[model samples]
Target: MTHLFDPLTLRGVTFRNRIGVAPMCQYSAAEDARPTEWHLAHLLQRSLGGAGLVCVEATGVLPEGRITPTCLGLWNDAQESSHARLAQAIARGGAVPGIQLAHAGRKASRRPTWQRGPAEPGWEIVGPSAAAFGDYATPHALTPEEIEALPKAFADSARRAVRAGYGFVELHGAHGYLLHQFLSPLSNMRNDAWGGDFAGRSRLVLDTSDAIRAVIPDQMPLFVRLSHTDWVAGGWDTEETVALSRLLKAKGVDLISVTSGGLDHRQKIDLVPLYQVPGAEAVRQGAEIPVAAVGLITTPEEAQAVVAEGRADMVLLARAVLRNPYWPAQAAIALGRPEALVPPQYDRGWNDWGKLPVELAVAEPMPAL
Candidate 1:
């Protein structure tokens, strides 16, 4: 049985352990959608905290794709140059640098959440259909020609990710993003080649995976984050997610990082610990694909069992890590596997970790560009 601290390798890249810091947006980018200093300090600390991987936030693949005007982006050379520094800093801190390529669709161009009440849309948004996510502005339905162009846009971002020194790349198909807008029946009402059936709905993501895999070296893994369910009746569900995962595996995709329910404001989720693991487990077993379980998995025991019981291949954390950036090392100590807290950092509290196999830093993987 694989434990939480066990190393996991996908394609040719190796993670020091199975605990990854889930990509959580800081919404602190510059006006041009470039990552600011906050993005660097925020992620590099998680790397040093002993996370196996630290994924960058949901970055816009195009200007209009941003969730907020301040969200990170990857469409240009300057952005790539800026991100290279982030990737290198995370690598030096002993974690694999990964990025989530995203387009927020109808959810784009809102005020940052910290701004609180009644955030209005700053720009026109696009979606699989004109259906809006509750009170957000109704989006323009993308034409067939626009649909055909998106895969290359994602592919171009993947190419830039390689050039930026990201060792892992994930397509953000979850949490009511552009790809999720196409997958869920409640949001995507199109009858054209881009919508209607499962095959049609899946085309954008499949084409995107194909495009991204074509450019990135075989050594790097491509992950897709899937919203396991839309949580409303007659919406996207586990069965469809399983089928999609199988096809994704055949397309040379490495893993599914399972999350759920951001496509609709009408979604009725019963929030609790491990609420979404079953979804991840279903995708892993039914599809016979590796999956990373996310959503409310907040405890060490819960995270350990997810991997050890063969329920999921990896356990990703968000709020848990945000509350404690060194949750990985702390979990190691709690599990009586205290070696992860070693190297006797000059920090006073960590000195009593007793004896441990001081880990040498992992060498940076060759840049794919």
Candidate 2:
């Protein structure tokens, strides 16, 4: 049986432990969509704090696909270079560097949460259908040709991620993003080949995965984040998600990061601890694929249980890690594996008697050469 601190090997990559830091948007990039110093600091710290896999946030494959003007992107050379630096930093800090490629669809072009209001006139948003998400402007429905071209766009982004030295790539098909829009019948109301049936609706996601898999090395792991449920009546739910997971697994996807909701405004979610683990379990059992569970998984014990009890293969921490970058280290100590992932630079921080320093480490001035 696997535990939280046990290593997980997917394809040719091995995570040092099962504790991964979920991608959280910083929304601090410049207009050019390059990662800023904030990203380096934020992601590197998580790696140094002992996360097994430090995933970059939902990065736009196209500029217009960004959730906000400040979202990070990899659609250009400069952005690729910036992400390369981040990938190196995560590796040097002792963790696998992964990235999530996304297209926000109708949810694009919104202001960051800190600056919420009407967005300045921006590029027209595109989706499977012309639907407005809540108060957002109606997006233009993508033409069939545009639909055909999307997989290439996603493939191109995966190429950039390989160029940037990412160990794995995750296709963001969840949280009402472009791919999720195609997956959910509620958002993709169309009568064409790209809609109206399960095969039609799932075509984009499968094609994108195939395209990405073709470009990346065979050994590189590919993950997909899917909203297991839309949480509204007549919306995409666990059954379809399971079917999609099976298809993706056949197409070379190694893992499914199961999350839920955000496809519809009328979503009714009961916010409780481990509320989403069942969905992950359902997908894992139905599809026979390794899965990662996320959603209010705060404590080390809870995370360990999810993996140890075979509820899920891994647990991703978001808010808990944000509050304390050293969450994994603390967890290691709590689980009686204090030496599991302590960085040598901070060896003094942990002792055999469960004593831990309040701070990770203090840098002393270098002696004069």
Candidate 3:
């Protein structure tokens, strides 16, 4: 049986283990959307912490696509150069560097959630329809010409990612973003070819995936993050997500990272441990593609069981990882796999751990990035 620490090979790239750091936005970028020192330190530390794959957060493909002015972007040379440094830092710390490309669509032009107030007026947001996401501004409906241009925009950003030295790329088709706006009927009320039935709804995502694949080398695995359900009646659900996964696989996507319910305010989710694993299992079985489960999987045992029991091929940790960047190493020790990746500087600390009781095995202080 595959365990959490087992290496996973997809296409020509192999992740050292089945543990990944789910992309979480820092919302701390400069006005220009370039990665700052915080990004470099945050991602590189997680790499050193022993995650097999360290994914940069949702980076915008266009300035207008950002969820906030502070989100990272890859549309310009400066941004691309900044990401190259981050990629190298992740690699140097012993993790495969990955990035998620996204467009925020109707959800754009908001203040950071921490600011806790109304968003200041900014650039117009665009989506499949002129619908507003809750109280946000009603986005302008995208024209056919603009819709046709989206794939090229995605492709261009993907090319920049390749140049930035990312070994893997995940398209953010989830979380009520632009692609999810096109996929979910709740947000997409368009009657054109870009919206209606499943085929129409899935066109933009499929086209964007194909466009990205056309530019990136076949050896570089591509992953897609999907909101497996909208958690409301008559909305996008697990079955549709499975079908979309199959289509994405046919278009050369290697894995489906299953996350759910960010498309609507009406969504009713039962938050619990492994709440989304079943969705991953359904997609993996239905689409015959590897799936990475995410959501409240905090402990080493829970993460291990997800992989070992064949529930999902991998598990991605978000808040848990942020709470403890070295969670992977601690998990490795607990699972009796002490050979897991540990930096040379930290070798003495882990060596002492074997002689000490579990409660006494404290981690050494991390060095400056």
Candidate 4:
């Protein structure tokens, strides 16, 4: 049985614990689409708080891939340098640095939640089909030529991530992003070789993974985040997600982070704790692959149960960690592990009931090809 406190290794990267900080969009980048001080501060604090891995938010691979105007990007040299700083900061703060590369598809060009009104003009929004996502901006249908070129765009971003020193790379194929748009029948209505059947629809993500895997070091782990179900009838479902996970595993994906809904506005998701754990377990068993469970995992006990019971290999915390940056340290005390989280400077506050070895070191992965 895997304990939540046990270190989890994927390829050459070793997380200090099963607890990971899920990427949350800061939406604080400037017009240049580079990391701002906010990103470094936010991510570093979480890393210092004792999370094993700190994944940067969904970043645009191309300028137009951004969901909002201020979202981060990795396409340019400046952005790559900025990301390098963020990645190194994470490592120094005691966590493996990770990044999620994404394209928002029809969902691009929308305003951030903090912002209001229609999206400002002069941005191109593209998707698998020319359809719009609910009341969002209508998108131009990507030509097959453009679609074929997308894998390279993603691969190029992966290459930059390698140089930027990210230990883990995740393709954001969920939450109605561009890749999810292709997977869901509701979004991808094309009749070409790029669409229609399951194989055709899944081509982009697979190709992107293959391209990245081929270029990155053999030791670096790659993860894929998938919306296990669209939660609407006839949309992408858990059955297909399981099937896809199998294929992704065969294609060199190390883990599948499972969550559901977010494909369509009509999606009807049940509100319950651990509602998505079953889906994660299904993919893990059905595909015989390592899986990360995310959703309403709020407490340390809940997180420990998910791992100890073999439902998921990891539990990613977003809102919980945001609520308390040192949740991992607190969890350590609750779970009877040593108070190995706080740094020497803050050691005086924590009770010294026991001691557990927690190394703030990341395994050295080979340089990118």
lDDT of 1 by residue, 1-369 (tens): 898989999989999889999999998999888888898888988887888999999999999998988899999999999999999988877889999999999999888888843235477899999888898889999999998999999999999999999999999999999999998889899998888999999989899999999999999999999999999999999999999999999999999999999988889999989899999999999989889998898888999998999999999999999998888877887776654433235344564465443433344353443
Q: Which residue runs does candidate 1 get wrong by more than 4 Å? A: 117-121, 340-343, 352-369
* TM-score for each model: 0.94, 0.95, 0.95, 0.94
| Total colliding residue pairs, candidate 4 | 0
Q: lDDT at 267 for candidate 1?
A: 91
lDDT of each candidate versus the true structure: 0.89, 0.91, 0.91, 0.89
Question: Which runs of model 2 end up more than 4 angstroms from their true locations?
Answer: 348-369
- 41: Cα error in model 4, Å: 0.5
lDDT value for model 1? 0.89
Candidate 3 per-residue lDDT over residues 1-369, each given as its tens digit: 888888999988888899999999999998799999999989989988888999999999999998888999999999999999889888877789999999999998888888843357678899999999888889999999999999999899999999999999999999999999999999999889999999999999999999999999989999999999999999999999999999999999999999998899888999999999999999999999999999999999999999999989999999999999999878987888764466666767866766622322223454465
Predicted candidate 2 versus true structure: per-residue lDDT over 151-251, tens digit per residue: 99989999999999999999999999999999999999988988998899999999999999999998999999999999999999999999999999999
**Residue 6 local lDDT, model 2:** 89
Please identify model 4 stretches exceeding 4 Å from their true place: 351-369
Query: 299 in model 4: Cα distance from truth in Å?
Result: 0.8
Q: What is the C-alpha RMSD of each candidate to the true structure, in Å?
A: 3.1, 3.1, 3.0, 3.8
Worst 10 residues of 4 by lDDT: 358-367
TM-score of 2: 0.95
